[model samples]
Target: MLAGPAWPHSTPPDHGPDMTLDRIAQDLFSALRFYSRLPTPAPADAAELWAAPDMDRIAYAIPLAGAVMGLLGGAVLVLAAWAGLPEFLCATLAFTILVLASGAMHEDGLADTADGWGGGRDAEHRLMIMRDSRLGTFGVTALILSLLLRIGAVMALMAAFSPIQAAFALVAACAASRATGILMLRALPSARKDGASATFGQPSHKAALSCALMAAFIAALLLVPLFGLAAAVSGLALCIAVIYMMAGISRRMLGGQTGDVAGATQQISEIAFLLAVLILA
Candidate 1:
């Protein structure tokens, strides 16, 4: 954009925000702004970030934002358990908190993705359908199935493990799956010429790798203790596999990724990880 050499893959070059005493912390806050309803950096702190690169690199921190979300939900589960609520009720309240925190952004994506891909006969038709705000048959079905699977898996994990263990597992699943969204963003071009996903730009390989390692570390720390090394490995693999499959589908059907596709990928990866936990935990 500065009239220099072009980036490969047509992705916009990574533009760094002004470095600060708390650059990473600020990036994390920017990520929260993008991914959830949580409060972020104050106006003063946010001003510089908005000036240069915008939030192009914030994708690297999405998993951290998701980890925060998951930990908050886990806290809710623990509090509900302490209050003597039934396991199912505790699980319900925890996930409900998460859905509220994220504004169900990723869930909305999955539904729209399903409708677009399922109802359209061609890529153009599918992209147009996806751009619509209204829900349809496929969207409704996808939402119902995704919600049931996610909630059911959480309840089962609660039943199968201690509150702390279950909470850790949930946190790990969330962190790992959300990273898939970032990875997907980096791997594909935007299907549309311009939108949130396209404008966000592609993360560098190093940034993507850092996000992946952070996700893997979080998963390994929490899951290996409860489900053993083998299961933990498999579960993380499952989440990544879901990302790969979803990315493949997005590429085939829509030509590239979009904000909605990234969101849908998060939902699918979250469910896949949870299902893996249900089976192996």
Candidate 2:
């Protein structure tokens, strides 16, 4: 496994002589490994890549990874809809594909964050609660609500628009939500010394900006054509609002950002984006 966080603080080992296409390809693979359960062939330096993922490079590729994942899940949604499946069942199946694709990493983060934020006495206590793997009442409730809300949002989108249009919305939401989540690395300090956020190292402003711009491009390319500029703009605004709200909550409760906070941000922003599409479509 990736040993203690030595490389995150230093020059990453994966850097090559230059930013060639090969390097960009490697970074994309690394991003996929970091963000999802998708099977990827190990590069020659897989050990070093896993040890200290160069978030600076990987950040740029995260939106693309999310877009790929969205396409996979959205394909299921489109096919099910075309097969005359119930909209609710199609939505649930699509959501299940997404959860399985990512191994529910974001969901786990959401649960831990809610439990810690809702039940802890202090920042330290909250961190402790988050570190515990056991599910709590707060976590259970948050997990259920998150799943239900997203599925419902998908159902609404299908009702309001065609499944193909809703699938594009899913792709845009996935890209945008992940882009929003990566900004936390720039927005707040790491909450714990050895936590995942800290171990992964803070992404520089340029990296975060690149991620955001790429996602915005993806959103515009996918969403604007379907829902119009106004709806797209509104969805983006709500995504930014989610980032700010999550940042404030994380700063107040955990004293900074963590993996869980990022996950929660993505989940909430996704719901916000889908709802915006449903309302406007």
Best by TM-score: 2
Each model's lDDT comes to 0.81, 0.85
lDDT of predicted model 2: 0.85
TM-scores, one per candidate? 0.88, 0.92
TM-score of 2: 0.92
Worst 10 residues of 2 by lDDT: 1-10
Residue 86 error, candidate 2, Å: 0.2
Report how far residue 91 has shifted in candidate 2, in Å. Answer: 0.4
lDDT of 2 by residue, 39-111 (tens): 8878797575467577887788898888989998899999999999999999999989999999998899899
Q: What local lDDT does model 1 show for residue 17?
A: 68
